[model samples]
Target: MIYRKDRKVLKRVDFGAAKNSLMGVLAALVVYALVIAWGRVYEAFQLETLLVGGAVVVVTAFRLWLVARFDALYGAGPARWRKLFAFGLILHALVWGLLPAWLVWRVGTGFNFFVVILYNVGVTTALGSSWMAGLKVRQFYILLMFLPVIGALFLGGGLREWLLALLVAAYTFYLFRLYRGQYELFWHAVTRERRSGGAERRRELPASTDIQLSLVYRLAHELRTPMNSVMGMMSLLEDTRLDDEQKEYLQVAGQSGKLMITLIDDVLDYSRILTGRITLSPDYFDLRGAMEQILEAFGPMAQAKGLELAAVVDRLLPKRVRGDRDRLMQVLTNLLSNAIKFSERGEVRMDVDFTAEGEHDGVLRVRVSDQGAGMDTDTLKHLFEDQFLDGAVDAFAVRHTGFGLLVCKGLIEAMGGAIGAESVEGEGSTFWFTVRLGMQADMSESSKLSGAMADIQGVVVGAGAGSLACLQEEFEALGSQCQGARDYDHALQALRAGHREQAEFDLLLVDTHGRRELALNLCRNVLEDPSLRPVKLMLMCTIEERGEPTVQRLVDKHGLVTLVRPVHRTGLRIALGRLLGVPRSQPVQDLPTETPEERRRRKLYRLLLVEDNEVNQLVTRGMLSKLGYQVKTVNNAETALALLDQENFDLVLMDCMMPDLDGFAATRDLREREQREQRPRTPVIAITANTAEGAQARCLAAGMDDFLAKPVHLQELETVLRRWLSREDDSAAEEPDSE
Candidate 1:
């Protein structure tokens, strides 16, 4: 009963503190008015000294009450107390110095100098000593000092006034030192408290390692699925007789691979709260234009999930706000993705509003609301906490990772704004965030959109002749300049020439249907060349089994952007818009790059091949030989390694999978071994089909430079030999070796 009573008393005290904060401000204002009126009354009765002293007392008391009220509201700590004392000193100086000076000048009283100086000293001393006394003692001291000062200035003689002024000045200096010393001690305590709290949080985090591991494991599994798809697509591309339809299917496979890579990157980013690393590289971008680009990316996924995704951007949202365009897209993507995932059948709506919320500061509020399964109060409460749902095992909800909210929170906070979620369980949830951005002054709508579009630079390489023509037509329609490059060498030359002439082309569209290897080679060449590095390369590939790996490598290795086979003019335009930093006006229509017969009419190449691996060598030799290539077999890199030393062959198909020397090391030995012995360099083709990522590049880097993926196709082998052998014949032909 006694403990309950004490708890009640403590609660009452808290309530009193709140009530006093509000009431005190009102009381102070009233007192200020009363003091002003009383001063006028005293002046009317010809009591000049009394009126001035009374006014000073009343004003000082009011200032003290206001400080107290602020403390009550905010809570009194060392920091608050120090601020209160500082404020007291400033108020005292204003009331004592300026008000008294003005009154003396107005009344023409030369004697008011002593009154002003005495009041200043007394107020300063009171402020300095305020923190030292107990509540009772402090209040008593205030009353005593103020009452006597009021009385003395009003009625005391000149000698007594001089003594009082001397005393006040000495006390004021002493009190100043006291207050300064106490403030230093208070700050030290605060620093220690913060350090202690941080240590405790660190301790708590390590204890939750099990929870952390679970989340990391799940995320890794999710990422691997896409990676595997990319790998599988790469393996399928070795088929020799893939028709146009088959190629189209592969192109879609490659697009899926690209999407998976992006998804993995985003998921990892959401997992790690490195929000500060997401810097805003802001360029001019239109509000609706940016949304359209994001919408296109999400459209297919939303459609597949049977979700209706819609956007409603208010015209008031400044058509262009200075911000990181990619980051904004990321923010929108995260929001839309989450909305779609959570919503079962209802719609996901994105509404953007621009409003001026502060002095010279404009705010863009993007509210992404969904008519989905709303979260409960508890879930919403813990939404942004990093570890709040770290241990959740529910696969459905876990997919969202709650990390998205954390990222959203960090981004909004970094942008000088706030993000919050409101939900009513089983009803719906609305997630909204605001960004306070400085409005761009003097930018017209068209200029803003044009400025945004102008930043993207596109480079299309190796587009099939037909696709190249189609893309050119589309470019002409869009008033964009199009340049064509037939092969890797042509693309590199064009890129170099453009760089040399300082010609600016907004987009580079490359066709990769029949020329996937050539296109990839060109992309690698451009990326490797320092001179052509400025051009943003986009690969246009037909649907083929190998499209996934090829696209993945293009994107991962060369940072190449891709548009799958059957190019849509609208998608191409938007991609150009995004890459070029243009505001998108409309979605590009999908246009088939190559007709069925056009793709079939492309030439196929065959070659005499040699490989060592019983499984790989037999499979590859059989596959290529079956596809119309005349293949030769060697048991090990040593035999082919020896045979290459003696013979001139159409193409010395070297196997990296061999004993005595591995394919890479053997190739190096074959290429450099000849260089060391002063023999002419033979074009050694690598035939080991290793599915490992970066395996082919590693083989080329080693020396027997040309690569044909394992289970080699007759056409790929033919293409590989055609490229190197043709180059050789143009210079000097060598005789074939009898193995």
Candidate 2:
């Protein structure tokens, strides 16, 4: 068995060693007592016998008392008691060691007297050897005690005495070796335990599929809990003063963590679907808005591969549709993810079209097309089957088709949709699904929305023919007339010609591709010309160019706008609006400055946080406090209930997994108490890493008001709080005045 040096293990060893020592001392005392009893029974009370028996009784009583004392105090005063115990052993050895020699010298070689004295000496020597017990210092005491007997044997000056001395030396050597072996064994176990600690004892055997799924789910939750803290703290760090390079590094770290969390979520989702526990919750949502978010989330992943991600929604499509928004998002996300994962270059596009429409119901089709390595006929034939991902895929490797696709198909089917794929073996693939959804009653709001960039004339320069065409389409959709030129010189010549022809341009768009120096040279030329000075300049630069001194000089020092390449339309539109000095026709809600009321509300919010993990508790508490909430933490549910009984709280953030009285039980009990006591229910929100399909339903059924998956984003935290915290329960506590 693997060993650990925990307190329980150490205590067992120490007590066992202490008991062995005590038993040796006790045995020595018993021998001395027996000698005294024999002397008294024989009625031989000579002065020498009296003195010897009296000394024996006195030493025996003293040693008995010492053993008792050692036993009493060893646990509390190990260092002090050990020394006293060893000293008692030495005294017993000395009395026995010298008594035999004294008896030989005094009793004139009497048979009975020699028998009694040698018997006592022999017993004491055996006890001393056993008591040595691997301690070098105790062995020295044993040797010292035996010296007198050896000296007495030599003084006798006979072959018998010499033989006795030789026998004694041989026994001593054997005892030394025994003690030395014990010493090595004990220390080896201790050192090994110390080095391994408690962690190494975990089993190393591979787990079965069910066990693997359980472990993956658990690991996903545990890992994401801390990663959430890391990403949250990194986001907070951005508000501090960091240079471009430092910020870039921090951003990369944050992006990696986000990617890891996404992978974990995929595993969690697949596990849920595998167990037949997943359920879809349908609601009305903005179709275009959801698509926009999907594109935004995957923007970095696509850009990393030099790929463009595009989302196309038919204008006639309903603005809001009733369906499982989250599930639909998951389906599209999985498809897009696989698209990006297998593709090296080119654009990954999502197309949303209405196959059929009515006032109440409509058929919506979504196709995710990617220029990636396509599937063979055999692979396509078994795509959605249960065994598709069974044996062919490695558990730890990046899979081309497996559980993720399985989950996507299951989710789509659950939502009353059919999923299919079209592919060419060497070219690319398109995966599509169609679902029925109800249209929003009010389509006027959707029709009222207008392009943000109206009444603008823009010119694009030096983009690849394909990219340039896409840029033109994006700009034209925004009600701007966009002209493309073949290259840099051609664009500059066209601009000069426009100036000569008295056609003044409103905006100048430049695509740097990857050459910073070339882009900078062109920028300088445009800035130097008086005719093009009024034409607002915006550069679509690569990720590396954002940190360049030349680009920084142009943006910060010279006031030019820069947008990173493989641009999403949202970012592009925002850049163009900023350059043109006009807000979008749709009111864009940027991060707002805090109002006085908002500050007041933030200060008044109080939260009770219940969690068992100390690290998660500390990090989450810090994050919540940083958001301006007053937070009190308890390690377990029992303490939480006790605290809630004594004081009032605005909300409680409960952790589902905990030792003794978990969050679910605590929430249930609280609800019962509220009912019995005729009091209003205080809002309890579950914050957990468990993302199994029914986790939220379980939380709500157990009387929690809401559930938040672990590693909650700051924005998500805000949204949840806004939804639940708005209902001020005066029965729990008076709402803070907005004065």
lDDT of 1 by residue, 93-131 (tens): 444444443443354222343433434444434343224
- Angstrom error of the Cα, residue 464, model 1: value is 43
After superposing candidate 1, which stretches have Cα over 4 Å from the reference? 1-263, 267-278, 303-306, 356-361, 388-400, 445-739
Give the Cα error of residue 619 in candidate 2, in Å. Answer: 2.8
Model 2 RMSD to the real structure? 26.0
Please report, in order, the local distance difference test score of every candidate based on alpha carbons: 0.53, 0.68
Q: Number of the top candidate by TM-score?
A: 2
Decoy 1 TM-score against native? 0.32
- Cα lDDT for residue 735, candidate 2: 56
Q: Write out the backbone clash pairs for model 2.
A: none
Tell me the lDDT of model 2 at 35: 45
* Candidate 2 lDDT tens digits, 1-739: 4444444444444455445555555565555455446534225445665666566566666656655665567667766665665666566667667765665455423343344444544454444424433377556555655667667766778654543444344334433444454454454434434345444443553334565467656666656666655565566656656657556655765776677677677777776666665677778888777777777678767877887766666656666888888888888888999999989977788777875466777898988888888898888887776652455642222224656788888787777889999999768999999888877866644211135456777888865554565567667656667887677877788788878888877677888763556767888899877878877888987666678887888787668888765555567767876776655576778666265655557667778999886656766676677677789999999999988888888889999988779899999999998899887678999999887657799999999998888777777777787677767643333254422
